[model samples]
Target: MRINVLQHTPNEGPGMIEDWANAHGHPMVTYHPYQFGHLPNADETDMLVILGGPMSPNDAQPWIKQERTLIQTLRSRAVPMFGACFGAQQISKTLGYEVTKAPAKEVGWAPVYRQSTVIPGIPAELTVLHWHEEMFEVPTAAQLLFASERVTNQGFVLDHRIVGLQFHLEPRANNVREMVVNDYPYIQGSQLNQTAADILTMPVLAANQRALFHILDYITADN
Candidate 1:
């Protein structure tokens, strides 16, 4: 399978996704738009992964505009796309939902309550990583996949293919440490009160990777 990753920053590259693809010997293409100033041709890959970044979807920037346009185009074709954190926020916004600040930052390990009315491929329960100060409203045409008190719209599925997950399912401890030091300034006084040490080795961390695998297997399978 050819999986394309849209990486907005150097530090926030694909973590477990890279490991899984390498282990499975699947072809991979990474679109570092922030550095390259352009995204790859959507027709080149079988899957699309919109990774997380610090910037909001509403940011007024040229690359942001390009990404939004690309996502919209992919959605029009019903491409099997999976979005994480800011990518989820962008998907929500592109699909007519609102993305805004939540009551809390919701950093670290958190239990995501998988809805009984979940997509056919997702697990019944998932303990994913959290590291966002914003959340998005569910698109009207999508089914709610998961929820949490901290962020009601934890996950959503559209057309039984596209998915948007606000929490991090592939969050690695090393990446968490990098985010703590690099993204500390943004969350320092925001609603999400957390530090790198608080969740580096939390038990829930293991489930995050499992959840990502389950999700990937589900989405990549023949429909």
Candidate 2:
């Protein structure tokens, strides 16, 4: 299978998703949408994964508009799409949904209450990584997959093909550290903000990342 990943920033590249793609011998292509502009043929890809960023989905940036258009096209075709954080907001917004500030910001690993009991192997609840200040409303027909204290719409599965997750299923220790050092300003003034020291000092996010792969494999299975 072919996978096209849209990277929004230099540091926020696809994390464990790269491992899955490479291990399975899936052809991987990346588009720095901010640099190359809104990829004209996004829907032509077999699977689309949009990474997170500091920018809002409503940002006035030129590529933002292009991405929005691309997202709309992808949705119309029901192409398998996976979005994280701001990418999730973009997906929800393009699909006639809304994105807004959450009541509180969750910056550390938190438990996700899985409402979709159909997910196999994993427990009904799990601790997932969190990093977004904004949240997205599930598309009207999408099913709720999980929820956290700060956001009721932590995840929504669409047509069993597209998925929007508020948390980072792609997180690794290094990415968490880089985010802490660079994106610290966003959390510094906020109340539930956890430092990179707080997250990196912990034991096991990679295991959780592996679990994330399993969940996604279940969602985007070709068979």
Candidate 3:
């Protein structure tokens, strides 16, 4: 399967999603829209994976709009899609929902509560890394699947083919380090934010990788 990843920044790549694809013998390609300002043809893409970014989905940048257009086209074709953080907001915004500033910025390891058992393998509560200040509202017709104490809209599953998450489950230690180093200034002051040391030193949780693989498998499953 051809898994196309729409990446917004250099620091935020596919990470373990690439690992999953490799393990499953699927080819994964990543597009840096922010830099190249180009996207792949929807007809050529089998599955769409949108990675997180520092920019808001509501931005007026041409690349952002182009990305949204691609998402719409893919959704129309019923292609499986998985989004993370800013990518989640993009999906929600394209679905006519709002992406607004969260009640509070969740910038570190946090726990999300599962609201529905529609997607199995994810525990009732799982601690995942977070670095987003904006949150997406659950789209109409989409099932709200996860939530956290501070963020009511942590995740949602739509049509059993698309999944959007507000947190980081695919980032490995190196990915986390890159993000933390590149955006160090953004992690200051918030009580929800974790220090660089804690974020980097935190042991990698096997559960996060398992949950991420489950999500990818569920979304891309042939139904």
Is candidate 2 or 3 superior in TM-score?
3
TM-score on alpha carbons, each prediction: 0.89, 0.91, 0.97
Locate the minimum summed-lDDT window of 10 residues in model 1: 186-195
Tens-digit lDDT track for model 2 on 42-68?
645878888898888878988887787
Worst 10 residues of 3 by lDDT: 189-198
lDDT of each structure? 0.77, 0.78, 0.90
TM-score (C-alpha, index-matched) for candidate 1 = 0.89
Runs with alpha carbons beyond 4 Å of true place in candidate 2: none
Q: lDDT per residue, candidate 1, 1-223, as tens digits?
A: 7888998876677888887788878888898877778887867767789999888887887887788787888878767788999888888898877899877788766678887454444566676677788898899888788898767888888886788899887657677766666765654553445555665556435666767777776666683
Q: Per-residue alpha-carbon lDDT of model 3 for 60-116, expressed as tens digits?
A: 999898888899998988899999999999999999899999988888887889998
